[model samples]
Target chain A: MSNKLLECVPNFSEGRNKEVIERIVDPFRKTEGVKLLDYSADKDHNRLVVTVIGDPEGLKKSVLEAMAVAVKEIDMNNHKGEHPRMGAVDVVPFIPVRNVTMEEAVELAKEVARQAAEKFNLPVYLYEDAATSPDRQNLASIRKGQFEGFKEKIKKPEWKPDFGPAEVHPTAGVTAVGARMPLVAFNVNLGTDNIEIADAIARKVRYIGGGLRYCKAIGVDLKERGIVQISMNMTNYTKTSLYQAYELIKVEARRYGVNVVGSELIGILPAQALIDVAVYYLGVENFSEEQILENRLLWG
Target chain B: MSNKLLECVPNFSEGRNKEVIERIVDPFRKTEGVKLLDYSADKDHNRLVVTVIGDPEGLKKSVLEAMAVAVKEIDMNNHKGEHPRMGAVDVVPFIPVRNVTMEEAVELAKEVARQAAEKFNLPVYLYEDAATSPDRQNLASIRKGQFEGFKEKIKKPEWKPDFGPAEVHPTAGVTAVGARMPLVAFNVNLGTDNIEIADAIARKVRYIGGGLRYCKAIGVDLKERGIVQISMNMTNYTKTSLYQAYELIKVEARRYGVNVVGSELIGILPAQALIDVAVYYLGVENFSEEQILENRLLWG
Candidate 1:
């Protein structure tokens, strides 16, 4: 468990130009001790998302090198995007993946934030686990005023940047960096077209509605499929297993005389999350991670 | 999917002597491209079990090296164990863990069997998937005659080995080499202590009893816990999942008003077996091995 792994997902403003995107991603590829897991761009959002995992120092080094490219290549004033943006290198999140701790991740985020603000003269706000106050914990709140609105918003007394000068950069604008747990995007489709059932179950299973502590749920209507989905963000799957939420939804659906058609897991998730569900369903006792053959290949 | 990985488990005769056990295990450690996953010696059984995984050629080379050490250190003429044995190295099974096919594993098994028999001057029988006939398919049937009994048994026309001489070695007896699918040691325990319910369900659920295609089940009485268990070996988990067998047992138990009191997974199993169970219970569609973070670290 002392292997020390962290995932860094940094989003940049430019997405259409392949050369610029490659230029910004080249450092991550060239950096030692860092593996570029994936990278994708959306022309409409005009955003490029790069995912990489490595040791703390290595990840920090790569992100800084990549940030330099974004700063030199992108100017927020000339940027146009369908998605909200506040800076050339919009946001970066450091996730504690394996042996790394949240506190350590928070420290790593702060170090990157301070170094980035100093190097690029870009205002940085710490959000989520790395936030200085509760108000800064939500990334959306800090990024509420997009690139244009952030120019005037940065001057407010309570809206001061956590790192660098109070003023936004002349071109790059501002950015947000944070440390947070891995999120599991899970959706359970009910065998009915009643969106209200999905809505009610979503509210019942979400954290605010007194369900799982680390869950955030919403209802989605899959019009073409003729079914409703209870979408969820399992913020901490270790504490709140995906199966627990699925079973709870199934129980709730039974009351409404509906069956669960199927479920979907969006994006990526830690292998342990899936293993936990396997152990639960199979009722496996005395099972260890070492029992999993891939664990040896991954760690040893 | 093209990445070839196979598991080789070789059982040796000498377990009481620490020096001999270490000597037999040394080659697997020193060999490149091979990982010595586990090795345990049971003094009562006077047997040494070694588990290793690697590319086909690497695994074959390591096993042959270890077999030489085992053959040199232990004399079958003086060997005795609670478990049945007919050679210094009793049996070797080649299991396709990932990407590797059963046909490829069988070829590897045959190559090892021919080489081991020629070098060591020991008789080797093909068993399981590599069996030349249905009678030689079971390791037990081939090894039914113990070392003392095997001397005379080997000269019989029907008992001739697929490799090496028809007669046994002066010190090292005959051996069995096999290629088989990954087997799952799964047990589903019931709330009742009555052995009949467990036995009846076991009969209804096993392949021989018109149930799952690849299941072998038996009922065990747990006097201490006041429960019964349906112990099973899912010989081919791909065709017959652990969940399917467990669910069927639950349905059968319900007829007798018995409840399932959890279950136990014995020894090591391939990770795909666990993932298959997760996919079944969670109803997760479109989930790929690539989505598991460890898979990126493992194959990437």
Candidate 2:
């Protein structure tokens, strides 16, 4: 069998200090069986996001190493960011990319969370598919109180993490580790500059508005381009595809007499996402990923 | 730079004999850096088609080994098959799958052809992008006389073999070796079984009929299913994408009051072919293959 590939995206609290960000991400570089696809630090959010993929064992080892570095360098007491956070090494989500099942991914995430908690003496909360309780399934719920408020909130019986002590660590507050489906950040730009039109369409097509499930959307202003954009996070492309979101946006925009200028994918996505759309548009029957020559060789 | 991937599909004349087929395909198995994607034999055609992909050097070495096995075991003088053939190890076409340019693939093909000719003392003809002359560019023209007639046909000045002596091998005959773009065997099934409608649409959409430049299409009857198919060999997907053919077929079928039931890809195709169609249908303004996380790791 081919190696099981798992994608890990870990968010660190220190994004302003370039040296600290590099130190946290350094472990993923030049590691055997581990490929560091991308890492970016946002000053405004004061957070660093690192993306890496590889064999399950190799990836777990590299991510642990990076976590150790983050624990040593970052202190949540002094952390300040626009994005919500409950720890120095904030959230680490393990996504199944290829030849891996969700159950296996969940087990891997739990193992990592256990190891991190035991070694670093840092609190680790299991969220998403790997959550210990239904209430903790959402990261926002786990991080409801941010780093400062988490100190008192951790003592609550329901807020107790799946792993680690009831109290937050002195430096690295806490971390959320779990398994989840791959997320696609897709943005659609409208010909008009009216933000209200973009907002209305976002509301009409998003899951919150009883539109498509597995979609989270918001409107943004692209002032320089003189256009309004509906940015979406397609959390589960298998159930709700990119094309589905695009078509819905197009149909919703028609109400306001707005034409879709174009769309863009923000970051990396699994190849299957695009293949699904292609199969739909081309009306191909009985198509398989194995029919892709490159995929065959890669899996082998 | 990453390793350049090249796909080689070689046809051998002895398909009826399982042992001979296995012998010809043995080299591709257990070879480091060389992946044997598929190998199949057709009794009616009396041919074995093997698909392998790897680095240029490794692929060339494996192909030569397979050719030597074919030359020693199969004697084309006594061969009989439905498919046209001029050699024991008939034709080998090198395709650029990733990171390799057409010129590089052509060079690789020539080197392999030269080695095969010198080692086995067999006549080799270069066709497609690696053709030495315009007349030699089409494999059909080189294979016109077949193995039985090649003895006299090869003696002509314009028919001089690109490699080895002008005379064909007593047992193996001649081989056609060259580079070409990946071919997608896409078949579109029509709602109706009217063979004439399928034939007219094929003629209207194929290159010979002043339709798409890179498409070669023919009509086929699927008797058991009670449907007609527009069988096509999309020679260059980069120039004429799968969607272009699919949409054109949909439009053409409408004129005949027939709707397309479904389409199928006969064999392995490059992932780019499907991705291109998805990008077109999605109206993605700036999409890159690198954005595919699995592809990034595979290519790296």
Candidate 3:
């Protein structure tokens, strides 16, 4: 087997302060095995999302070091953003990229959660695939009242923390560590500026509305461009391919006489996801990732 | 910039002898920074094709070691094969994979060719992009007379070896070394077993027949499977993408009323080649390889 690669997208609560964000991301940059793919700070959301991929052990160590920096430099009590959060180091989701199983990711998540809780005296909750109970599986459920209400909410038996003290950390608050599949942020732009058409199509093409099994979508107005967009989070590309969502959107848009102008991939995504879409569009048979020379060099 | 990567596909004369094939392939397997992507031996063709990619220096060293092994074990005088050949080590093509230009590949090829000829007392002829003259640009032209005729062919001033003695190596014969674009071996199978229909489509989809500029194709009968195939070598995917070839074949097949049953990729191909096909078929706007997570992780 080749190297086990795990993608970790860690969100932090202090995006407005450049120094704090840089400090928190330092370990990831310096870590030997860890590759820092991308990092961005949203001023409106006041959140920093850092994308990284590396071996489980190296990733665990690097995340721990970054978490320590976050605990030291960020104060969640003073944090304010458009996005919801419950801690200085808000959430860390481990995604299995290559040569790694979901079970292994869950195990790694729990291990990192335990280490962080013990090392920093900070409260940690296991969510998503690493959740101890079904009720905690959804991240929003655990972060219901955000940082302010977490202190009181954590004391409840049903809402007890997975690790460390039940009470929230005085300044850092609490963090959620979990394992999940890679999420693809895909968006389709329609020729018409009518937001209603995009909204109608998005409703019929998402999982919540009985469409694709693992797709979550919302319609947004691209005011500057005079067009509407069907933004989507493809939670599981294996079950709900990019092409399926694209074709569905095209079909639905045609109902309202709207043509798809183009599409956008918001961030980094697994190469296999796009390869699958290529196979579908090209009607290729017996296609394998091994046939791609670069993948073979990296994985072989 | 990331490390420069070059792909080398070397064809050896002895494929029937497992021991000799293994000996020739061992250096590539053990060399550092040189990844042995694939190695296959065809009994009928009596040839061994080894695909590898790595840093220039490391790859050159490994190739030389393998060539030495091939020179010692394989004798062209006693060689018998269905595939055309003129040496123990028939041909070595250097392809620029990533961060490496064609000029650099040509230089590397010339360097390796000179080294091999000097060290082995073997005659080496540069072909393809590294050809000393336009007449030697095609491997088939340089290998016209085969091993037995090379002794006299080399005597001609126009056919003098690029390096070493003008005469062939009595036992090993002459080797061809050069640089060229990555060659993609793509085959599209048709539903019907009508070789004429396949041949007609192949003629209309190949460069020689005024079809795609970078394509070379021929019709082949898959007798056992009861189908005819258009076997192709896409010499430059950047200029003539896989989709362009596939689409052209589809258009030509329509003339003969034959349906495409399936397609096959014979060996490893650059990921960019497939990505181009996906972008064209999906009609995606502003798609960049940086958006692919694995590419970013590996090359960013």
Clash counts per candidate, in order, are 0, 0, 0
Residue A257 in model 2: shift from native, Å?
A: 3.0
TM-score of chain B of each: 0.95, 0.97, 0.95
- Tens digits of per-residue lDDT, candidate 2, A208-271, equal 8988999999999999999999999999999999999999999998888889999888889887
lDDT of 1 by residue, A1-300 (tens): 127999899999998999999999999899888889889999999999998889898899999999999999998899998998999989999999878899999999999999999999889999999999999998889999798998799999899999999998988999999999998999999999999999999999999999999899999999998899999999999899999999999889988999998999887677888889999987877788877777776675
Cα error of candidate 3 at position A28, Å: 1.6
Model 2, B1-300: lDDT tens per residue? Answer: 137888899999988999889888988995676889999999999999999988887898899999999999998878999999999989999999888999999999999999999999999999999999999988999999899999999999999999999999999999999999999999999999899999999999999998899999999999999999999999999999989898999999989989999989888988888889988888898798889876887774
lDDT of every model, 2 decimals: 0.90, 0.91, 0.91
User: Docking category for candidate 3?
Assistant: medium
DockQ score for model 1: 0.73
iRMSD (Å), candidate 1: 1.4
TM-scores of all predicted structures: 0.96, 0.96, 0.95
Which stretches of model 2 miss by more than 4 angstroms?
none
Model 3: per-residue lDDT, tens digit, B214-239?
99999999999999999999999999
Give the worst 10-residue stretch by lDDT in candidate 2 chain A.
A291-300
Interface RMSD of each: 1.4, 1.2, 1.4
